[model samples]
Target: MTIKFRFHPEKAVEAAAILLKLHGKPMKYIGLLKMLYIADRLALKTMDQPITGDRYVSMDYGPVLRGVYDLIKGQPVDSALPLWSKYISPRDSNYVDLLQYPGNEELCEEEEMILKQVYETFGHLDPFLVEELCEEEEMILKQVYETFGHLDPFLVAEWTHDLPEWKDPHGSAIPILVEDVLRSMGKTEEEIEDISQEAQREAYLDGALPKIFG
Candidate 1:
């Protein structure tokens, strides 16, 4: 009498097949991973996060571990978890180094000029980011404290939500994630694609021909 939120075995196999197709020539392990990561990120965007003792785990992990507990008998999962997991955890540097900022002290004019120059040069963005500052510079700066824990209050109103991001599960993260995988698979090197070029352009190109043919 054990129930689990696990994928159906046949379904899992088929899903793995689909992932293989999606991953193209990637190694089996890498392809499997991309499938899982993409699925988890998507699930996070659409579901309530699960409660797990001290910290809330992603809703994706919830299904990945449903049988462990009926747990307080069906209370709704908390919404705070997503904000914490997505915005706060990495900021604290307690977990995986997703996207991290040194700190958001107002960049000196020289620093600002440097960032503007570098960001403009390759059109790249903050490190450890899953998405882009796609919002207004004001909005992005406002969140900088939350993101980097030290943005100057004076600069809070600067970022607009218009920069850009990769699409779908990727949003701002698509380009980096794909490229990291590619690099790991020996497809490309860090020096090849200029970091100034936004990951969005690369991901868009990745999908174009397939979408066009489809």
Candidate 2:
């Protein structure tokens, strides 16, 4: 059975604040998004689940966390608008500021470690450079897709394989599923259940599960 992922807005707010703190200054919205994406990818690789559990999509620029991207843009869903407005800056500005610190109650130690690692690795880099890297990855996926067509074996490799929890939609705009991401990581059903349950519990404790899962 496929497991559907749910977004945790409280966690997203906390993650954004953590990135801002690591950045040590206001951050370009795009750059912040890139860092969050990298951290989520790292989490999926090591923990079998993403931090925010936001749906991902392969865009021309790179893979994006759909809900988090919207939140960054100040256009979050109705349920997320209050928390997003209280914490995140307007997206029209060149950079975003943390209005208040969202505590780390939503994050586990491992997730915090991955966020720190991602920031240390890529936070100082230019946002455009990060976007270019993502474009390059997309190019590779596109080439492989064209060469192999859409057969399951070839598509699986080209779309996921050793890649970071991303799937090429083969020219279509289908959103990648969390189930596919965990599968790409070779997580067993038990592992998936454990990760998902933990994430849900965290969100519930943070009061985000009701808003997202309702």
Give the TM-scores of the predictions, in the order they appear. 0.20, 0.67
Give the per-residue lDDT digits (tens) of candidate 1, residues 113-197: 2222222221111211212111222122222222222222112112211112123322222222323322333433433243214
* Candidate 2 residue lDDT tens string, 19-99: 666566676775566556656766776656566667777654456678877777767474987887787777757678777
The numbered model that scores best in lDDT is 2
- Each candidate's number of clashing pairs is 19, 0
CA shift of 4, model 2, Å: 1.3
CA lDDT, every prediction?
0.24, 0.58
* Best by the TM-score measure: 2
In candidate 1 the C-alpha lDDT for residue 172 amounts to 24
Stretches off by above 4 angstroms in model 1 are 1-4, 47-214
